[model samples]
Target: MTTEMSGADILIQALNDQGVEVVFGYPGGAVLPIYDALFNQQRIKHILVRQEGGAAHAAEGYARSTGKPGVVLVTSGPGATNAITGIADAMMDSIPMVVITGQVGTPLIGSDAFQECDTVGITRHVTKHNYLVKDPAKLGDIIHEAFHIATSGRPGPVVIDLPKDVQVATAPYRRTNTSALPHRGYKPAIKGDLTAIEQAIELLSKAERPMIYTGGGIINSGPAASMVLRELVKLTGAPVTSTLMGLGALPASSPQWLGMLGMHGTYEANMAMNQCDVMLCLGARFDDRVTGRLDAFSPHSKKIHVDIDRGSINKIVRVDVPIIGDVGRVLEDMVKLWKAREYQPRDLKPWWNTIKTWRDRNCLAYPASVESGEIVPQHAIRKLWEATHRQQPIITTEVGQHQMWAAQHFDFESPNKWLTSGGLGTMGYGLPAAIGAQLGNPKALVIDIAGEASIQMNIQEMGTATQYRLPVKVFILNNEYMGMVRQWQDLTYGGRYSSSYSDSLPDFVRLAEAYGWKGIRIERPDQLEQGIADMLAHDGPVMVDCMVAKMANCFPMIPSGASHTDMILDPAQVSGVMDDEAKALV
Candidate 1:
């Protein structure tokens, strides 16, 4: 007794089977049938976003925070095109996401029908995988396949283009029960070779200056991976430094912890990477940002790269040991192997001495707020962490100076707490992402630490927060400039300023109020702590606009194309004409 159902019904049912609790999307002409089907569905909830781009980023936020594939539903043409940025961001950072777009009818696709574009063709490059559904009966299987491709292996966004006529047509819904579509071709390696594991351990056992470099792969592998990572770090007593995406994979309070290692990374971490005898790279690609000068990066180290993707190995920096498998599974095996031998902590006293010497520089230290009597952006971020009592809070940030400061100042002690646009560096990603995080964890204190200019990119999503009563806090470091752009001009372009100034900014307090939310403005250092606390304590959405120092720049920067050893440790001054306060606004 097979039941007949529309393509939309099968698609929605498949989503229910996959356990997608919520979807973020915008309604348009082609998607009307699916939206209609969605209205009566009790198993899934849909969040109607103001823009399609917000839908994609919100899904990213949901995926990162929940360890599940964030689902997106949008219409064809501009709606699908708007999601391109997030799709690319997820692909680069490896976040699991499924985007289903309603396309023009199959017959109308080539005819330039209303609200029609090549959704598959345009998104083909950005997505991990894409499908253009030609047959109505295949909708259910395609829906399930999208989830499968999005969440498996190195997770990323997958798109499905559903033609309007097919969505409205009848299907048997055969994919509803136990028989799932077999995907025999996409088996990712989950276990590494025993010999390789043994060899890796031998290197760990003998190395004096061993360091662990990790990235977003550990987080994408789930909390279990982080557990094994902590155990492995403990077993060897080696220094651990994470890339920007790997912040919460290791506890920030551990004695073995060096701060993040990269271009804007802590000096101690970068120096340790440059000098380590053996480097165990786990679940992290050697990104250009992390490797300042590829040839010079970790020149003294014999590197072991452990990643699930075999293609990622030796793609940038050649590795001495390449172990391809799921990071969690590999880490579990390593921990078990080490415990079987009853290994004691390695002798790291000398290594610790050198690290301590570098830490003595206090490279991460910004001017004291009380000393400067000014609200530096880093100081504000440090205060934000302090106000939260250094607890693991769900923190998201837009790209640029605020993102780096959030990464540097906030100490994340657990996985899945720090979310940001890591690889693509998308602006306007924070606020919507925070909304998704809040949606995932209703009771958690979710904050989007955004810069003033970047927040405007998807600022319209504030209404969504208010409508849902999500209790999201948008904490703006209102430096009145695009700080990173200004930093570059000061460093490379003779400080010309060149259209970086973000002038004619709106009154954020009024804007929040207009969106039916609470708003607070903090203009001085003394007002910050309480202001942030107030925003978090509010039962509903609140946006706090903190007036930050306009001229402040993020330091410990690896200048473009320079080695990690050659860092701009302090603010570079521009003499004569461009020295005025007006010249360097971002």
Candidate 2:
């Protein structure tokens, strides 16, 4: 004997049981029953997004910032299809999310009825797991399990396809025990092997040139991991460099930090990566962007990799010691072992001196001042950082040259504050991500550093901001082109910028005003500071169209198939077109 409840009601109760307070979603015919259930209850709040894609990105931002699994709901057919990008984005970046999509009634699922689709079939590759529920009794357990799987080992998005009839059906609602999820085979390694940890420590202790290469894994492990990493860096006195996703793991202002390492990475960081005798990789897979040419990547170094996922270890670059466990715990073990042995690392002053010489190149150097009426994008980013760093703002970015510039200029002091699309390089991630970030951290300043072309991908989300009264800022670096595409075209295709030019652009200020938000336009160098000041002063959503130079390309670029040392630092060095083979490497 049990209390019977509608599948829709059970779904809501299950979400409540899992501690989900907010869901980003859009309603439609197939999901009417669920939406009606949502209307009757106040325990869970729903954010009505302009588009399904925006909902997914907003959930991603919320999850990335809060370290909680983001929730999403959308109707069947196009609604489910529209969220593909965001789901894939979560999969690539390893975000925790549970997306519930409505489907046609069970009888209609295979009959090609109106708005019918094979939701689970389509999302299988992009999700950690998926479910198509025909039975209402099993729905509650599946929902609970979805959340557990999403938030568990090497977190990622999970999809649940609920048919309209199933949602309307009645069933006995028994809340599942979240801690004792039925997926017993999915346990992830937490504590590392102590012997392997001791061996890694012993190797590092004798190394004359040791380097720490960490990535998003530490950030995903929670803030404590970052703290342990900082302590470990201090004890060993090793130079540090991070991938784009791993930026905030170590404070950018730390003396040992050499800045981000990769295609658009700092010269000093890349140089150190190339020259280090001992490399300790924590929670980072050696992505192509970071490794450059695999054959030439850190050839002489004895590598050590620590990661929670066994599959990620030695998947790309083989390491001498592979410690499979949570990055934070592995680091803690290493710290304890080093202290117990009283190990002291050899002098690395010579290595530091060599790194200093690379830093002296000032590869990021660009004209700080452009004459009135023109802005350099890099300078604009630096100025944005200058004004907002004191507040320790949460910064988000759309994928493009502006994203790289923000990574270069914005010094993140802690984990979970910087949000951007790293693995997927999805455009239009910034504005909506800022919306979620602002809502999650109501008192904190959340800004999206967007490129002109990329912002248009989801500019409609400003309406979502206005409706919610979120004071999220959109700072568009108006370069009048798809900056990265144009850069790649210039490098690999003989500067034939075919479709890269942004033509017929809308008046962003007017668009902002029409959306019931304040707008600012900065066309000159003199107005930069005050414009930013005015934007921050406004208590509502604001859009700043900061006009920047069109032809300025991002520098310190390692051409496809080039080694870490073979980077082009200036426009003058960009010459020659690559063949078809070279074009595919990047």
Candidate 3:
């Protein structure tokens, strides 16, 4: 039986059919009808964010932590524009998300009428796929299709521009049992070529020095992929290193783990990549940060790249064998084929010895307490990990030195427990993402390990946490500088500090009080442990500001345009200011 309802109601019904429990958004004139429809329903709860940008980031946090597509709703014009940053962030990191933006009536779309703008046109590049709904009858189908595209095959944000007229128009809507609207041309490959899997196994078996480079694709493939990844590591006995976005895909406690590999990666991980004979790249693209100088990156290796997106394979660094299929599926096939042959794990004693020598450098070691009693950022991150790691907290971070420090120091034992702005490196992503993560995992510990400068980007989101009574914590490593920018200025611009100094910072304790959150400020090194305890003991949201060293710079860094081997291990290793050519590289 076909039931007649307004497009707004049909949208709500479609969302219900898709089993959407929560939506992060802000309501406005264009979305009034949709909001009205939302108000009438009890099944879907809408979280009202202070800004449209927060909504998108919160959705990102929710999606990344939950392994489900995050949903967003906002009005037209500025509302849609505000969400572009989060959408771009999700697209770059391959997060599954669906955003519905309310547009002006169909006739007003191109007229610049009131709040109307080119929503579809503006979001086309950021989204995996997008749709502009002119017909009310097609609304449900489009909604279903949007979710399908957003969640499947290299997951990313998808936008649906809904006009006011379409929202008000009546249509015959039929409830469908299936959540996805099938598209014949959009089927993504799931299984890998058997021959290629066999070839990968053969190369891995013969190699004396082997490295397994994994990334976010394994995390996106769910817990099963991580399990298979562990099994594969056991069979191959190869050292494993992951990208920034790929943290937590494998247990850090594992002996085969080599930590993250990139510009700011560990010494052992980077050295392993540089010296490997056979490099098995799984679900990780060789981005500039990871590859350093492309020509010098893993030059001695026979690379085998496995990725679901064919576009990602050989995009930056060409591989000897390219297996285009789902990472988890391909890994399963490889595991079965290898076990069927009863292949013994390779002898890697010499390789392990070399890696251990690199590890002896203690690249991550930092002063626990300075002569001035100021906190070291690296030490603070390590202490923070020690305090909360037992609880298995979900940690999110804003971009900068604090972010890299957290990535290096904080160990993740399971997947989905660590979320951060990896690709876009958005400054204000952590606070709102923490909010989203907390809401999605109500009982679990959720913390935003933020920097003083970056935390202020969406500090207003503290109010959202207070309103919901969420116990999300914000641990701010206060150094009074946009740390990464300052570091870059030192290296690229000869220590001439520019606008990176955050002199006009707010009193975070008072700011937290104003937002109805518990606040704590730890200035001395002795106060760090107790302050963390109090924040964790709080029943509601708490924000902690831990003052740290000001002039600290992250190490084991491959300077821009330099190879993995050309790393600056410490401040003394920095010879002079870099040239314009090196400064141009990120």
The TM-scores, one per candidate, come to: 0.96, 0.99, 0.99
For model 1, state the Cα shift of residue 325 in Å.
Answer: 0.5
Q: Which candidate leads the pack in lDDT?
A: 2
Native-to-model Cα distance after best TM-score fit, residue 296 in candidate 2, in Å: 0.4
Off by over 4 Å in 1: 176-180, 370-372, 572-586
List pairs with backbone clashes in candidate 1.
482-586
Q: Model 3, 1-586: lDDT tens per residue?
A: 5778999999999999888988999999999999999999899989999898999999999999999889999999999999999999999999999999999999887998998889899999999999999999999888888888898888999999999999999998876544345687787778999999999999998899999999999998888998999999999999999999999988999998989999999999999999999999999989898999888998899999999999998799989999988899999999999999887767889989999999998887776686448888888888889999999999999999999999999999999999999889999999999999998999999999999999988888888898888899999999999999999888888888989999989999988988889899999888888898899899899989889999999987999999999988999888658878888877
After superposing all C-alphas onto the true structure, candidate 3 shows an RMSD in angstroms of 1.1
Residue-wise C-alpha lDDT for candidate 2, range 106-131, written one tens digit per residue: 98889998988899999999998999
Q: Which stretches of candidate 2 lie over 4 Å from their true place?
A: none
Candidate 1 structure quality by residue, lDDT tens digits, 1-586? 6888998888898888888999999999999999999999788989989999999999999999999999999999999999899888999999999999999988888898888999889999899899999887777878887788888888999999999998899968865442355577777788987788878888887899999999999999999999999999988999999999999999899988899989899999999999999999999999988998776898888888889998899898999989999899998988898889776656889999999999998988888776436698898998899888454689999989999999998999999999999999999999999999989988788999999999999999998998888888999998888888987787767777888899999999999999998999998888887898788778898899999888898988887766778776777422323333323331
| Deviation of model 2 at 220, angstroms | 0.5
Query: Residue 417, candidate 3: how far off, in angstroms?
Result: 0.6
Clashes of each: 1, 0, 0
